[model samples]
Target chain A: MTLALRVEHLRKSYGAVAALDDVSFEVERGEVFALLGPNGAGKTTSIEILEGFIARDAGSVEVLGIDPGDRQHLRGLRDRIGVVLQELAVESFFTVRQVLERNAGFYPHPRDVEEVIDMVGLSEKSDAKVKRLSGGQQRRLDIGLGIVGNPELLFLDEPTTGLDPAARRTTWDLIRHLAAEGTTVLMSSHYMNEIEALAQRVAVLSHGRVAALGATATLGGRDRSEATIRFTLPSGVAASDLPITPWRVEGDTVEVRSDDELRALHALTSWALEGHIAVTGLSVARETLEDIYLALTRGDRAEIDEEPDDTKARTP
Target chain B: MSTDVRPAPQRSRFSDLRLVAHQVKYEQLAFWLNRVGAVFTVGFSVVFLVMLGASAGSQKVQSLGDISLVSYYVPGFIAYGVMAAGFTTLSVTLVVRRETGLLKRLRLSPVPTWVLISSILISTAIITLVQALLLVVIGRYGYHVAFPSSWLALLVAVIVGILGFAAMGVAISAVVPNQESAGPVTSIVFFVLLFLAGLWFPLPPNSGLAKFSNYLPVRHLIIAMDHAFGVPRGATPWAWHDLLVVALWGAGATLVSLRRFRWAPRRV
Candidate 1:
């Protein structure tokens, strides 16, 4: 498969602190790749380096087969790439349409300004000055400017940070649509749900290093982590009556760990039937992406109480 | 999945030029929309011209044998107006843009660095010229100040003054820590230079202050403008020495700004 971006052994430092140390990852063409991390986790540094805004002290970075660090290749590479920075960058006085039209002139080939405006759901506010638009609307204008160039690879840094839930969903749809149309996207976000919904693959960073990296479902061995079965015992049923021995009891709720979920579930149902006790509020859950992420980044420091009481998942 | 993908077309120099033109156009639009800033840029010079003309209309300067004090003040205020547009306005705008992350965003765009700088310079030149024209119109109609005897010399001096001050503005912006500091810093430097260069009244010739002013670009600009206005006969319209001084300052400031200007805001 052709790769849209490749970063190997990237190293950057600010004085004595290393912002990125030996960070490496690859994004295949036409895939939505995510960089997930908490604040100061090197997400912005890595994105800025790939955007060609900052020079790395040491690394090999190639975007679409062009070295982003090479100045001579910048114009050609930038023509095919789009960046949505964290800050709102458009002039506050320019109307949405005007801003899009002005940015469109910078590219050799660009989408029509009207089309871009509509694509970002700003058609209704196209004539409104940027200063007059709401915060979310202004962000939509920022996204419009990014895509008006009809770029082959788009970099979105915290694109949905301040967006409301509905707007966030819309942005996710737009990103998926772009990927379906063969435009590769690299996005950084702290929203776990956003990453779970949009990213096919993810790299989690912590303390300036890759804490975990893999397909979304398999990241940090999330898919292999044990499933949890929680049920509220019927009235007059004691924890001793439960068939599962290794269970945590709180009030009337008992949580059972299961290596083989189906077998454990079958055993519990049979036990309940034999004892003539009804199980209520039964919930079977496996480790979610969030669980794996917290485990990987926080290691043993992650609060045990926060984890779904079933089985301890190994931290990557 | 295999699919045919077309290679992006090669960009041409014409596209760069077109982008620069658009940038200039937008810059002008934004400047116009900032009504308070636009007014202050030209208003200070207009206020000085009117006040000086009203108070010193009948007085005559010994250096300018036939020119009245009002006419003598014309070149000084014109110099002041150009400085306001080229230096104070440009520097403050740059500081604000950098602080607000606009410069960083522009840097990430496909537009070349030269294009962005050139567009700012072009827009400043245009705005300064308009201010100078407005001052001229007010001087003629309201105060009866005569038109410049040599338009070519006046044009040359104005162009040189704008280029020099614009470069100085960019240089000053490099030193300003943030937008809040931009106003005070630019004002302090401008007012000090304006006083030394004799904006309100001419400094006595051959005095200590006069000798010190000789090194300043504003002084040379005012001297060039005085000759351009034909106040004293036998004075050459082109003050080559003064023009050279202004040109040198412009070159020096351009170099300094190129080295010091930062696309990102200061971390602190």
Candidate 2:
């Protein structure tokens, strides 16, 4: 597959702090690539570099096979690359439809304003002033403006950050539809679950570098051979004389780790049968993307002393 | 994916042109709908015209053979209208956008930055032109202010003045950290210019301050505009010098602003 975007050794700094350091990633064409990071993790910086909004300190970056800062090429690529900024403060004076229509003029083959409006579920609020729309509705309008140009590549930066759960789901569906229509999407979100649902692949960033990256199901070695089984033991069991099986117990519940689920289940059932013990509240679940995300972020945060003031400084 | 030719999107300067025109059109519509803004422009013109009418008598102070105090103030009023359009409209809108985060949102659009800035300039210019026409009509009917002899120079000065002040406003908006500061900063700068440049009242002709006012842009613009009303071009400096200054200021402002502008909120 042709790479839609490629970055090598991208670096940026704000004063003494490194915002992005030695970061590299490739997004395949027509694929949904998610950049997952906490606040101040340089996702915005990376995306801005690709969008040619800010200059990179040192790096070779290419979007659509063109250097982003080359004005002519950048302008040429603009119509094909749509950027949905996190903030949706469009000029409130103009109606939603008017704003979309004005932006549509920049593209050679823009989608119809009406169609984009309907796609974002803002058809009913099309004529309303942008300032008057509810937060979710304004976000929908922002998406409408971004896609009105029928862009081939879309950059969505925390697009659903402040949205309620229902609104966020609606936006997710809209994004899925866009991807299904062959538009490449690069999304950034703090919500790990959202990324698992939306991104085919995710790159986890920490301290100016990629901490982990892979397909969502297998990210951070999640798909490796391991299963965690939890079961409640019957009364008078697990006093350290249970069996030769690999297991640990805390009170009545026992957690067993095994590479073979059938073997573990067989051993546990046989032990219960032999002992006339009942296994209660037995359940099995796989490691989720959230688990990997937490482990990575926790480990990464432990490596750096992030003063709380630094977080406050990043927010307005 | 081979041989997938959908007739690649056309590359055209006209694309930016059309986009700019559309932006200006919508901005103009919004400005017209702003009742407070409309009152400042149109209502201010009416008030200025009525004052000139009431004082059109022996209260006249003649700068040229045929021109009266009414005609002199007519040019000043028109210049004031232009200033308000350029500085107040553009600055207030920018600060509000900054406060509301609208300006940052526009930066993310595919539209070129120049297109966005120029669209605002063009929209404000068009609105000011309408106000100027209203002033002209009121001047002719109510105060009997004649059409100036130097119409071309007056037009050039107004256009250059608009560009210069709009650029300055953009620069001002950039340094202003927020909306509240935006108001006081713009108001102080604007009122100082109006006071020193004699937009409310012309400085004494041939006086040192009046000559010094020649260096101020609005002063020359007003003089040039009055010249459009048949007022002679005094041996003093011509309007073109002020226009050159305005052009330089515009370029300087654009450079400073583009460099200093930030897309995200500042760290407090």
Candidate 3:
């Protein structure tokens, strides 16, 4: 696959706090890549560096095979890259249609402003002032601006951060459409479900570094074959004194993990039959992205990654 | 088996220019709607015209005693109109855009920086021209001011005044914190320059302050317009020195803005 953007050992800091440290990732052409992180995890900073708006202290970054900061390439490069900034700042006086029409002029071949407006479902509100639009409508306008240039590479930074479920779903459809048209997208989102629904691959960033990078299903090796089964026993049954040595019992629930689903099922049924214990509310589920994210980013793990040298010295 | 590859299509120069023009057009539309632009245009014209009428009645008038009271105020008011539309408008727009992040968005766009700045400059220049023509018509019909004796000199002064003011406006925006502060800062500086440069009223045409005014930029611009009205010429050395000072200020403003201008919100 052709690579659209690549970063090597990117580093950024504000005073003593590191915003991005030794971060590296490659996004292939025409792929939807998501950067997942909690707030203040340098997702925005990394994207800003790629957009040519900020310079990195230590990194060799390339977008569309050119250094974005080089002035000679800015016009051409900007035309090819669409960026949806976290905060959309449209002049309160300008209409939605006017804003789109104006931004279209910045490219050699921008998509038709009216068509883009219609696509984003802002046709009725086209003539209304931007400040008058609803939050979701404003987000739509921001997306409209990002796509109006017909950019080959698009950057979406939390495009659905404040949207309602219905609006977010609509936005997802739009993103899917863009990706289907072969536009390369690099998105940073805090919503893991959004990433899972749209991304071909994801890089989970914690503190200043990537903790896990892979397909959404497999980040932190989350998609495991074995499933965990748990069931609650009646009051007469002793939860901890189950026949199965490997199972964990707490409150009235007996929890078991096994690779062989049928064998585990057989063993649990026979054991319950012998004990004359009634099992209720049994559930078996696979590991999810949420579970993986929790495992990777929880508590001291982030602190360790945040200050690896301090962690190493203390451990020794 | 045969292989054939087509060359890539090249973008037309017209296409590029059209894009730039479109961006600039949007910018001009936004500036027009901004309250400051409207307030300055209307307020400057109304207030100055009234001041001219009031001053003409109360103050001693010389130079072409035959010239009507309306004609006497025309050149000065037109000068005021140009400064209002161009310099004041440009500075406020810059600071507001900075505070609002519009300038940062522009920096990220595909248009050349020169084209962006030039479009604004050109728009303000056009607005000034329109206002000047309107002021001249008003002077001719309402106040019965004679047509400028040297339209060429007035034109030169207007252009120079625009360049000096617009550049200074941009430079000032770089230092101002936000749009609200920008308004007061620009107003204070503008009034100071106007009074010292003799925009409010003429100093003695040959007095020491008038001689020193010849060295002040606003003074040179006003004098240049006043000179176009067949007003007596000032000390040649001082006038040239004033022109030089204004030109230097303009150049300095542009350089300072270029060096220090930022288009992004500071990292929080």
Candidate 4:
């Protein structure tokens, strides 16, 4: 697949703090890619560099086959990409249609203003002032402005950060629709479920470094990792009498860790049936994406606690 | 197929002038639809003229060549309206937009930077024009005050004030840290300057208030307007000296804006 974006050795800093260090990633033309990180992990800095909003100290970046750092191509780069910032940037005074139409004027090849309104589900509020709409509706409008330019790639920075469950579901549906229409999306989100639900590939960033990068399901060896076997022991069973070695025992409950879960479960079940030992509450669990994300960024989170608190609430 | 990012050679896509006009249309819509702002700047001026015209308009001050109070107030408040729309309202608007992320969003769009800035400046000029016209009509017909002898001179003063004060507005916005403090900070600074410049009542020439206000751009603008209206009965309409001081201040403010302007919200 042809790549839509490429970055290598990206570095940026503010005074003494390193915002991004040697960050690199590539996004294919029509795929939805995700950047996952805790607060202050360089997600925004990276996105801004890629968008050419700011200059990077050390990096080679190409967005849509053009060097975003080159001033001559800055407008061209912006024309092909759409951005939705964390803030609801729409002015509150103008009606929904007015604001949409105003932004549509900025693009050389803009999508139909009415079509954008309908796609974002704001047709019902077309004449209402922006301030009168609910938070969810405003966010949808923000996304509409992003796509009104008919962008080939879109950037969404925490698109669903402060939304209720229903609103988040609606936003997710909207994003899915855009991706289905062949818009490559690069999104940064703290919501594990959001990443899991939307991204085909994700890069976990920690301390301005790529801690892990792979398929959403298989990152950190999650698919091939050990399975955890848990079950409650019989009341009179002695620990040593078990055929398999137990990892931990608490009261009448027992736990086992196994790399080959099929063999482990077979041996345990056969022995239990022969001896008539009733094992209750038995279940097998594997590593989840959240578990891997936490493990990768645990140190970064501890370090961020020492800084100012605005970056602290990204945990989900 | 994915390697080509340029769209249709972009040169023939659209006109930058049309983009500026479109953005200006929204900017104007935003200014007027926010009724509080429109009333605060435009409506307030109209009300001030009617109230003062009824109370002390016919009385002669004997200080400003014994011109009627209405004559003095008409020019003074015209200057006031210029500062309100170009300086106070524009500065406060910039601060709120900067702190709220609107400015940054505009920066990221495909529109050229010049277009956005030009649109805002144009919208401000339009507001100041409306207020100036309203004040002129009220003084000419409502209070029976003599109109400016050189309408062209009055236009010059108003235009200079708008451009200068608008630059000062952007300059002040760079220093005001956040939205909560924007209104109070700009208002206090604006009202203090207006008071010292004798916007409410004409200051006697060479009085202590006049001397101090002479050092400021505000009084210079009012003086320019007063001369344009032939307030002292046949004085030359172009007070080029006073207009020069106002333009210099605007130039300085433009320098400040260039050096310090920030689009993104402060991290606070």
True contacts kept of 3: 0.37
Docking quality category of candidate 4 according to DockQ thresholds: acceptable
Best of the two (3, 4) by DockQ: 4
Rank candidates, TM-score, best first. Answer: 4, 1, 2, 3
Per-residue lDDT for A10-105 in model 3, tens only? 998766888888999998888899998877777877888898877677889999887875756756688788888776656778899988888886
- Which one is best on DockQ? 4
Ranking by DockQ: 4, 1, 2, 3
Task: Report the lDDT tens digits of candidate 4 across residue range A119-171.
Answer: 99988899999999999999999999999999999999999989999999999
Error of 1 at A41 (Å): 2.1
- DockQ for every model comes to 0.31, 0.26, 0.24, 0.41
- Tens-place lDDT per residue, model 2, A1-316, is 6888899999987667788899999988888999997767778778888987777889899997788867667767786788888766666767888888877876778998899989999878888887788888888888887788888789999989999999999999999999888888999998887898899999988888888888988887778847888887667764465553546778777777777877778877798888788778987766788878777777554222332111110101
Estimate, for each residue in A1-316, the C-alpha lDDT of model 1 and write its tens digit.
Answer: 9989999999987766677889999999888999998776788889888988777889899998898888888888888889898877778887898888888888888899998888888889999989999878888788888889889899999999888898888888888887888889999998999999999999998877898999997887768878889999779867786777646888878888887989989989998888778788999999888887787777432112121111111111
Q: lDDT per prediction? A: 0.83, 0.75, 0.74, 0.86
Instruction: In model 2, state the lDDT of residue A3.
Output: 81
Clashes of each: 0, 5, 1, 0
* Chain A TM-score values for every predicted structure, listed in order: 0.89, 0.88, 0.88, 0.90
Model 1, CA-based lDDT: 0.83
- Give the per-residue lDDT of model 3 (tens digit) for B1-268: 1112223325677765665577667766876777668668756776677667756764445543434455546666667766776667777777777666577667777766767777877777777777778777766676656566767766776777778878878778777767778788888887887777765555656778777766656776666666666654231212344456777878998788776666664333
Scored against the true structure, residue A113 in model 3 reaches a CA lDDT of 95
Best by TM-score: 4
- Scanning candidate 4 chain A in windows of ten residues, the lowest lDDT window is A307-316
Q: Which stretches of candidate 3 lie above 4 Å from their native place?
A: A12-18, A225-288, A298-316, B1-20, B51-58, B61-73, B191-198, B203-217, B231-239
